[model samples]
Target: MKVAYWPGCVSRGFTPELHGSMALVGPRLDLEMVELNRANCCGAGVIAEHNQELVDTLNARTFALAQQTGASMMNICSTCQGAQSECQQRLDADDAYREHINTHLEPEGLRYEKGGDWSNKNLLWLLVEEIGLDKLRERVVRPLDGLRVAPFYGCYIVRPTGRLGYDRFPHRDKYLEHVIETVGGTAVEYAGSHKCCGFPVITMAKATSLRQAGRHLADAIDADADCLVTPCPLCHLNLDLQQPDAAKYVERDLNIPVLHLPQMLGLAFGLDPKELGMDKHVVKTRDVQRKVAELAAA
Candidate 1:
């Protein structure tokens, strides 16, 4: 019931609503989430690709903070989960890397006491495992009756099961849809739900990111989804923020609303539009908000 949550850099800044909504929604589902006092980046940004040592040291800081809670850690960012997920395999297989990581933390007097390595959990797993479907079903204030949601998995979040085991349960749509159902929403079956969302190719080349994103969007739109949702902020960036650029590259316009799973859940929990931070996104949530209001009224 008690767990620590790590909201990676983007979630802290651009996706405040998702984080805020998690705090609001988790407790209602009987999860007592303890946020790390000084939750920092999980050493993901460019460190993971360029420097292994820096990645370890940087992430050790987050581990150090989560260990402070003395409870299992639940994570919001898929990339952060991937980093921590990756370290799980290292800490288990290579004592040298693990010890060196801990040694780096010694100067700060922070020790990595491993009864087990960080219990890196994704929000979906936490809901399915920690809070059962029955409890989820009990929380529905507004059901997504007519809405068909497209679940986007992207990549890092679901691969390499060293963390949330999302790979084992590789259906991103179902989890969001489950919560959607709890609030009376229909989790519409759709194609492109498990596509990569172009995370790897995004920053490497604009063309690559564009083509990949446009294709993914085009597929989702073609599937007749009312809205697209994802747990990963990076995926949200590509699928939501970069859609305009992607559309230009593909030479087509897509007005599809990309919803962060928590943002949708927060609205169902009766959170105000401001509390969900719906305005900060590239695509407006006004129509989505109207639908929710209509659903609740109905």
Candidate 2:
């Protein structure tokens, strides 16, 4: 199962372990993860608001690189997945836009044709749809038996409607839960699971963003969850990096640890939490690690 892997901007610099854990866990799942050398930021789904053309050209080139690999483009970040997938869909449907994009690509010795034999696939979809839950369960040597996980989908991953193929029913909210249970963790449903982590509004309205992230954490805490797990890097930033701010706004101590989906998966695959970058989190993960240790004993 070879695919061109794009960690996007945030995961490369902010949460590198997301990709690192994937690299470690890929072979266990027979996943051949190939990095995209020519890929740039998928505009983080923000540049489109200011310059749609730049976003389109930027993503078209990324798809072009994935095309070279003769495999689908696999994205770790939800915003990157949505942005690039949206661009691919537009390029395939719009001829004039495709010509315009190709004109820009021509200078760099790259060409994009409509209805090309390439596509973008989200990493979560690759796991659930392609890899299968039973297969993933088989690799879980360290089952998260006693841990209670709150699955946060954030926004853009299963949203904005009518874009990605994974937007179908039964998966929009349940995919994360399925992955959690596959690793032997109990999935807790809270108000935060389907809510936005408030990354998009972080720059423009910092306070509002913090409050939103705060509410999500509060919900998870209220539900007595052990940790929060998400596939989106921005969500992890809000839920983990900005946790102090979220605590301030919510007027409570929101101390729950947040983990990248891969980090949780890595732990279940029997990799050390430190190796998966768990110790690097703003919120302490030692308790969660200890809990896993306790589960091992039980």
lDDT of each: 0.72, 0.84
- Residues 1-298 of candidate 2 have per-residue lDDT tens digits of 8988887888778888787887787788898888996688898777877788888898888877777788877888888877777787788788888989878888887776555446576767778888899999999999999799999986777776677664454465578999999999999988879888888888899889999999999999899899999989989998899999888988999899999988998899888888888888999999999998777767
Kindly state the number of residue pairs that clash in model 2: 0
TM-score of each: 0.89, 0.95
Give per-residue CA lDDT, model 1, range 171-200, as digits (tens). 543566566666666665655666667766
In candidate 2 the C-alpha lDDT for residue 131 amounts to 87
Residue pairs with clashing backbones, model 1: 140-182, 142-183, 143-183, 143-184, 143-185, 144-184, 144-185, 144-186
Superposed on all Cα atoms, model 2 deviates from the true structure by an RMSD in Å of 1.5
Cα miss at 201, model 1 (Å)? 3.5
Instruction: Judge candidate 1 at residue 237 and give its lDDT.
Output: 85
